[model samples]
Target: MEKVKVDLVVTGYVFNDKKEFLLIYHNKLNKWLPVGGHMEQNETPDEALLREVSEETGLSVEILGKSEIGMGGNVKTNLATPFHVNVHNVGDHDHCSLFYVCKAKGSGEIKLQEEEVGGFKWVKKEDLNQEFIPKDVRNIALKAFETVE
Candidate 1:
């Protein structure tokens, strides 16, 4: 059997003044992943990233700067990211992830898309090692957390 391909995914490294990272509980796979989703038609990778972040965390995020647009705009390959593959979650498919260093105005009320994402949390970087996020995602979060200050 052939492995399924996610194709593309967008992620946001949401940071708070306390230097905590925002993670969401994805209902699709029942795993904690970055706040992101599949790219919709005619939407740019950045647009998709921002949309997903808002939909998941209800936080308005800004794209700090430019990043490489991957093939078909399926993935956003940012140089600022710590990973080699543009997509953080690989082994699933050839994907490019758009990573943004964003700040939430405050810990406002979050409106999670219950069907897509069940819950969200602002967790400290150190706490992740003891938590259960994907290895690749945890590494990416750690790198982003270090520079969020």
Candidate 2:
């Protein structure tokens, strides 16, 4: 079997007017998480995030800006300085995640890709405290919410 190459991935925290965060169920992890994925060849982080969020959640979002959240993409992939990186073992592989905040264009029923995700939901900030997202990502979401409020 071929090892999955570590690379820089971008994620978007798509929040709606109702203050609900968009969460997707990742089939690989069997857990719920924010919308994001690997950057395609020659794609910038911002560009990659926009595409990933739209593909995963079926919603349009505009990325705010690049904020270093002490996050990392992967160990094998060389990441620039000031990114908060932590190692999370995923079976034989590891995930070093970078996150960003984004604003959705409008609210509507999400069209999920069945192969990649089992489902999606709009989670409120209060509900996130007990939700399945990682602490770091949750912190980012909280900060985004606080700023918008």
Candidate 3:
């Protein structure tokens, strides 16, 4: 059997004040996806998602999750638990993605990273069923809405 390469990545479902979630048209994937990207060295999943959200949308986001576990001598910090985790193939490789639910913080504009994304949209529950949206993405997006509700 051939070995498959998998990379760690983070994805965030960023919601605005109006209960709309942000979706960006990924240049490489050529599909609409949540704001996220590959994790950098020594960065936690939450940090990666936060950075990706800011870079993709130019908006500060408050990731929603909690870890009641107490910190110890070896534990520098407790990371927020991801709302969902999945390992999906991306043709040439696979991505072990940690999905975080986040809400937009303060005021900001939706400035997309032109080179990384082709376009972006703020979608509501009704919009998730669009033909262009992948099933997993649609399911996860719906879960995100149910989570905040």
Candidate 4:
């Protein structure tokens, strides 16, 4: 087996009130994928998820799931849990991705990250079969769709 470098990454399956999923055309990967990237050091999965969504889609998102943990007196932090986790190959490396469901905060225009993303779209679940999307991505997207619906 070929040696593979593994890295932790966070992904968000952002859905609007209409239940359409957000997808982006990654320039380097040449495939339509969810909004996500490598996790930065010292950042929790929830933090990374939110950051990636905003950076790639230019939309502030509200992650779905329980955001609060009551450990004791006056200590609380809101953070979402990953709906799914998977390891996928990306060229010479693999990413252990944490997937979370999310919703857009407002009606904001998408601003693609020109360097990494080539295009973006809010697609219906049925549209996952489009040629531009990879099989694995489509599977993950389908699950995310079912999750929110």
Clashes of each: 1, 4, 0, 1
Off by over 4 Å in 1: 1-6, 66-94
- Cα distance off (Å), candidate 2, residue 20: 1.2
**Which one wins by lDDT: 2 or 4?**
4
Task: For candidate 2, write residues 1-149 as lDDT tens digits.
Answer: 78665656776677787878788889988988888888789876667777888788788886655445555676333222212334455676666666666778876668887889998878888887774787876777777677457
Worst 10 residues of 2 by lDDT: 75-84
lDDT of each: 0.70, 0.72, 0.89, 0.85
Question: lDDT tens digits, residues 74-136, model 1?
Answer: 544453342224743445566666666666765556788787888887788778875577787
Local lDDT at 61 for model 4 = 90
Q: Pairing residues by index, what is the TM-score of model 3?
A: 0.94
Question: Per-prediction TM-score, please?
Answer: 0.74, 0.74, 0.94, 0.89
Model 2, C-alpha of 124: deviation from truth (Å): 1.3
Which runs of model 3 end up more than 4 angstroms from their true locations? none
Clashing pairs in 2: 70-84, 71-84, 72-96, 73-96
Higher-lDDT candidate among 1 and 2? 2
TM-score of 4: 0.89
lDDT of 3: 0.89
TM-score-sorted candidate list, best first: 3, 4, 2, 1
- Residue pairs clashing, model 3: none
Ranking by lDDT: 3, 4, 2, 1
